[model samples]
Target: MATQVNPPRGMRDFLPVEKRVRDRVLRVIRAAYEHHGFEEIETPVVEDAARLHAGLGGDNEKLAFAVMRRGLEVDDLRAAAAPLELADLGLRFDLTVPLARFIATHRSSLPPVFRAIQIAPVWRAERPQRGRYRQFMQCDIDIAGEPGITAELELLAATGDALTRLGIPDAFIRINDRRILFAALDHAGIAPELHEAALITVDKLDKIGPAGVAAELAERGVDGERLLATLEAIRAGESTGAGGTLHGFDAAALEPVRELLAANAGIRLEFDPTLVRGMGYYTGPIFEIAHPDLPFSIGGGGRYDGMVGRFLGRELPAVGISLGFERLVDLVSLPEEEAGETVALLVDKEVEPTRAIAIKRDLVAAGQTVRMQRRTKNVTALLEQLAASGATHFAFVRPGDTAATLEVKPID
Candidate 1:
């Protein structure tokens, strides 16, 4: 009996149709990131265990795919042990941490306020469910060395614009400042010391509702009155009096954010009070984008001002966002069959290599995705299979022909 081969749990193999849609999503995002002056960069999928540990915070430590080396002596340890620590140098969890390390290592070569875009895979050791995966790609854009709110706003606007251009016009970019969230917690009678617990609870507001959140808070030692106050404060309507008097930092502190949102006339922008992102590195304005039809966020990111400093020993303010490519694919209706035209190349056994190449090139140049008929079937059989596979056009090439004739037919 033969054993069946399968992809590792929580990982997936994208079929041709799925790959097309995923590629489309990536192309649109890459174009958008480049338009915003973000230079593209690549980072190693594996890093030194020490650097990975220092850059990715505590929660991620458990998820590191640690590696060990064998078959090498202490004298031969240098050569043999090089690849052994693949586990120690776990797969990157996200692009931001790697970007920070890249900038710090290449500080002299990079410009002040460096802008970069990275598209790569990240791994998480969480249980897999409907939309979540253990390994997935994240499209990220980050800017370092600018601490102003305007920088944050620009990222928000760019993110909104990218989604809008991708046909998710109804998507909302929910924005919130960590400072504002803290201020609201302080007002609710939760002491600054318990703020992290309060944030973890409040973040679940959408998932479990107010009662569930309150229960969670109570478990963390929050008093009933204080928990209710916190919920009500966050649920309070948008502030009207410049900075609404919840926290000492008046509307003036929030004006830059407010103004930026107001300027974006097309996209739906909202100041969400409960948007406490799960990551620990975020220090300033944080945000997540949601679509009316999608149950999960399509993308999110925030300011991590101290990350660069962790490596470079100097504060370099940065903010960025990532687009969930797979989630976006889920939201879009598959392309209409009629809208997609595929060309099938039917080659005779005696066809010369040069002529076959020319025919394929011509069809591809005419904006068609070409698939060469395999030797598994005769020409007639290949043609029948191509028709069944949704190919609308076909080209038959004979040996030594200067121009291959295309027998175009539309499939119903």
Candidate 2:
């Protein structure tokens, strides 16, 4: 009996149609990033475990897919063992971390406010679900430089523009500042020490409703009154006044956010106090884009001013945003007819190699996916078989022809 083979859990193999959809999604993202003056860059999939550990904060430590040295044993004699002090690499958990490392190593060769777009796979050891996967591609855009809200707003606008262009309607770009959330927690009487844990709990308010969040808080040692007060404060922020004007509040900590929202009136921006992003490194404004009909967020990002500084010796203020390519594709319903045609190139065996190459190039140049025919005997029969295989366009190459021509023959 042969051993059964299968992809590991949480991993996926994309078929032709699926790859086409994914490629289309990436094309849109690449165009958007380039339009915004972001230069694309690639980094190694694996990095030193120490660097990955230091870059990603505490919670991510458990999620890292660490690699161990082969043939190393606990009982190996100290005299014969080579130093394994630097267990120098593991798969990157996210693109931003590696970008930070890249900047630090090549600081002299890069611009001051470096703008980069990275699209690559990131691995995690999390359980898979509908929108979540252990190995996934993250499309990231980050600007590193002077600390200001303009950079943040620009990224936000880019995200809105990209999704809107991708035909995703009814999507909301939810905005909130970590400082504001922290201040609200303070107002609600939650102790300073409990802020991180409380925010982590609050971040799940949407997924696990208010009741569920409150229960979670209690489990994490939050009492009923503080949780209720915090919830009420968040609700208050969601209301627009009778005159359709936003309610006034102290804007010192949220000044940057307020200005950006006021300027971008057309953006579907909303301020939700309960929007606590689940990353320990987010030191300032945090935002997430969500679709009303979708169960997961389409994209999200926040200011990580200290991340770059961790690798570099100096503070490199930076902000980045990542688009959930898979989730975005899932939300879009593309029309079948508008999709590109898949051409099956049926070539005669006696045809010179140059002719086959020429035909393939022409089809490709005309915006078609050309699949070379493998079998040559009974060409007509093969074409008939291919027609039933969902390929609509067929290119038949005879031994000698001045130019390729399409002959539509009625099937009997």
Best by lDDT: 2
Candidate 2 structure quality by residue, lDDT tens digits, 296-402: 78888889899888889999998988988778887776444364566777677788889878878876787767777865767678777766654667666677742
> How many clashes show up per model?
7, 1
Q: Where does candidate 2 stray beyond 4 Å?
A: 74-87, 234-251, 334-370, 376-412
The TM-score between candidate 2 and the true structure equals 0.82
Model 1 spans > 4 angstroms off: 55-58, 69-87, 234-237, 240-243, 247-259, 262-266, 333-343, 347-370, 374-392, 396-412
lDDT score of model 2? 0.75
What tens digits encode model 1's per-residue C-alpha lDDT throughout 1-412? Answer: 8786888877899876677678777777788777877789999987667766773454675565655534435566554544434334567777787888899999999998788889888887768888888899998888888877667666766676677667788898787777667666666677888988778778888899878888888888876346556535544635553346555424343554566566753457777767889877888778788887777898998888888888899888998888887688777653443456787776777887777888788877877788876444555676676776557777665666543456656544
* Clash count, candidate 2: 1
